[model samples]
Structures are given as C-alpha cells and as structure tokens.
Target: MTDLLFQAFIAAGGTAGFCIIFRVPLREIPICAIIGAAGWILYNVVLLTGDDNKVFATFLAAALVGLLSEIAARIFKEPTTLFTVPGVLSLVPGFHIFKAMEAVMDNNMDSSESWVTITFKLAAAIALGLLAIGAIFNAAHAIFNKTKHVTTDMMGTLKNMTTPPGKK
Candidate 1:
C-alpha cells in the first residue's frame, strides 16, 4: 500500500538523519536507513495481526534490526551499534511519551500511568531483543573460532608426525 511505502520512506529518512547527526560514515548511511525501514515495516506487519500487543511487535522488530545489523557489521566490518542504534529509532515510543506528558499536564493520573507503563514495556522489549541476538551471535562466533583453532592445531601436529626425524 502507498501508506506503508510512505511510512517506510519516513523511517528511512529519520534513520538517515540520525546517522548524519551522529557522523556515521557516508557509505553506511544508506544501509542504516534500509535497516530502519525494514524494522519499522516489520513492526507494522506484526501489529496488523490484531494481537494488540505492541511490546511483542516492538520486540520482534528490534530483533530483526539486531539480526540485520549483525550481518551488516560482518559484511562491512563496522561496529553493530553503528547500524542498530539508528535502525531502532523508528520503533521508539515517541508518541507514547508525548501522550504521557499531555496526560500529566491535564492532571489525568490514570492515563499518564498507563502510558508510562506501556512505554517502559516497549523499551524493555527492544533491549531484550537486541541482547538476545547479540548473545546468540557471540556464542556462535566463539564456537566457530574455537573449532578453527583446533583444526589448525591438528594440521600442525599431523605435519610434524609426517616429517622424518633427521630433517631437523
């Protein structure tokens, strides 16, 4: 739909702006923008299922962003935060913060409390999602490097065994 495209465009632009403000590499700006757009789109799609669980939607979106950021970090040899920090900007509950402030200004304690609770939940979901992906990738990387070292050591031992004793 046109609306979805428009939202994606907005998210990308916001992400690009964030990169610009933070002085991210020029070459990385577009990649960060795409990551942000993808995350926002995914959040929207998940919400469309009518589950009404914005926290879960945010968690999934942040996880997707984390996954993409890790892949991009490997391919580009840049820090994952360079991609992930900007990529998650779109999912931040800015509207909820505004609503909470407005409720406070109007002396509506109940509404303000509800908005604050939801905002905190959404923020936690994002953090947990990113943490989950980072742990998985780090564990995998460690396992892979361990295996590579073992294989290299085995190759060296095999070479030593095949040589004649007088060769030294």
Candidate 2:
C-alpha cells in the first residue's frame, strides 16, 4: 500500500512538473497529474503480476492513460491533446525503443531479439494509445453533443447543436 501510494505521488508529481514546465493551466494540473499517476500504477501492477506479455500490458496502460486524459480534458473544458500528451509521457516506452536500437547496433543476436520484442511492445503501446484516445474523445464528443441543448443562428434559424460549433 505504501509503495503504491509512493508510486502514485511520483507519477503525479512528474506529470504536474511537466504541466508547469509546459505552461498548462493551473486548474488542469491536478487532473493531468492524477491521470499520469494512474497510468504508472497500472503499469507497475502489470509488471508485478508476472505476465509474460509485457507488450500487451504496456499498450493497454498507455491506451487507458490516453483515454483518461481525454476525459479529463473534456471535464475541464480544455484542449484534449494538451492534457493527454503530457499525461502519457510517463508511459512513452522510450527506454524500450532505445534498448532495441542499441541491441541492433551492437550486433548481438540474442540481445537483438530481446530488443526487438521490446521495440514491438513499445510500437504497439503507442499505436494503441493513439487509437484509444482518438476513439474515446470522438465518442465522448458525439455523446456530449447529442445530450446538449441547441442554439440559434444569425438569421434566426434554429441551429440544432450540442456544442457552440467552435473550438473551446
């Protein structure tokens, strides 16, 4: 329990730091930080579970983080990409990709295979992350718009829409 809490704090602090450095809104900082922390926790859980499929675990965690970030953005009425991008930084799989490339460069076949596996995992994670975020955001937008009220046009025409038909 303590370990988990500590991990969460680290993840949140790192995410909040990124937001501050990037000049993200103060109001959105806590949301992004929590999202990052959740992603890290999920990642650690998968690692500790002794699952052989690290790739799948990584991808799932990233996708989840992305989706949550999008949700936070919508809730806060901010740019979805802005929140999601920073929140997912902790799960970007950069080290895996680097190790894969290093293995190839060193001409070690065994190391190369291990690195290749990691590379694939990282690639899958990124791809799934982007896909999940895009799908969730799109779906949420649709649903929210459908449930929102309509508006009027300049010529007194009834503009039946959920949002204001402009970027927020």
Candidate 3:
C-alpha cells in the first residue's frame, strides 16, 4: 500500500520532468503536475479494483486529463495543448512498447501480437478520450459564439424596429 503511494509520487515527479522539458510555464507547472498525477493515480485505481479493463481505465484517465487541461487552460488563458501534450506523456506505456518490439525481433509472433494489441487498445482509448473532450469543447464554443451573435443581432433588430422609418 505504501509502495503504491510512493509510485504515484514518482509518477508525478516524472511528469514534472516532462513539464520542464516541454517548457511549461512556471505558474502552470502545478496544474500540469496535478493533471498528470491524477491520471496516473486514476489508472492504478482502476487496475487495483480488479476490473482488468486497462483500456477503459486509460480512457477514463485520459478523459480526466483532457477535462482538467481544458479547465486549466480557461483559468490561465493558456492553450489546452500546452498542458495536454506533456500531460499525456506520463500515461504512455514505454516499457510495453519496448517489450513489444523486443518480442517481434525474437520472432515470438504471439507475444508480439498480444503486446501490439494492448498498445493499440491503450492508444485508441487515449485518442478517443481526447477526441470526445475536443468535440465537447468545439460544441460549447460554437454554441457560445452563436448565442452571442444572435443576442447582438436581436438587439440591433429591436433598436431598428423601435425607430420610425421617417426618422431614418
């Protein structure tokens, strides 16, 4: 139990290194770290629950990361990509990818195929989660812009209607 806690901090520490390398702003570093750590922790939590659906776990974790990135972006007036690019790095399965390639070189087709499938599932989850959030962001932005335009147009129409044609 204690070791698991340690690992979570390690994950966050590693994420901090990524933030540094990515040149994330000092003020926003904490937010990036939080998003990364939360994702790492959430992934483990799902596994620990014995659900065994790593793809779903990754999906949930990435979705949280995207949602948090959007929130942070709004708060700091920064781009979501700024935080998400590095934040997602923490979730990548580097060891799995390495082993997958190693299995391929050893001519172990079964192992290689299994590893590749796992990698694909994890990657797809991350991609889809980000996509889902992106769709939400676009929809919200469009709605807000449309509403603003309609409100302004309505005000202008009301003004014109109240003014007599003779006055023009």
Highest lDDT: which candidate? 1
- Pairs clashing within candidate 2: none
User: CA shift at 106, candidate 2, in angstroms?
Assistant: 2.3
Better of 1 and 3 by lDDT: 1
Least lDDT summed over 10 consecutive residues: which range in candidate 2?
Answer: 157-166
What TM-score, computed on C-alpha atoms, does each candidate reach? 0.85, 0.74, 0.83
lDDT (10s digit) by residue, model 1, range 1-168: 898899899999999999999999999999999999999999998988888889999999999999999999999999999999999989999999899899989999999999989989999999998999999999999787663333226446543242345654
Please give the clash total of every predicted structure, in order: 0, 0, 0
Badly placed stretches (over 4 Å) of model 1 are 147-168
Q: Report the lDDT tens digits of candidate 3 across residue range 43-113.
A: 88888998699899989889888988898899899999998887777778787799899999999999999
Off by over 4 Å in 3: 147-168
Each candidate's lDDT (Cα)? 0.91, 0.80, 0.84
Q: How large is the C-alpha RMSD of every model relative to the true structure? A: 7.0, 5.2, 6.8
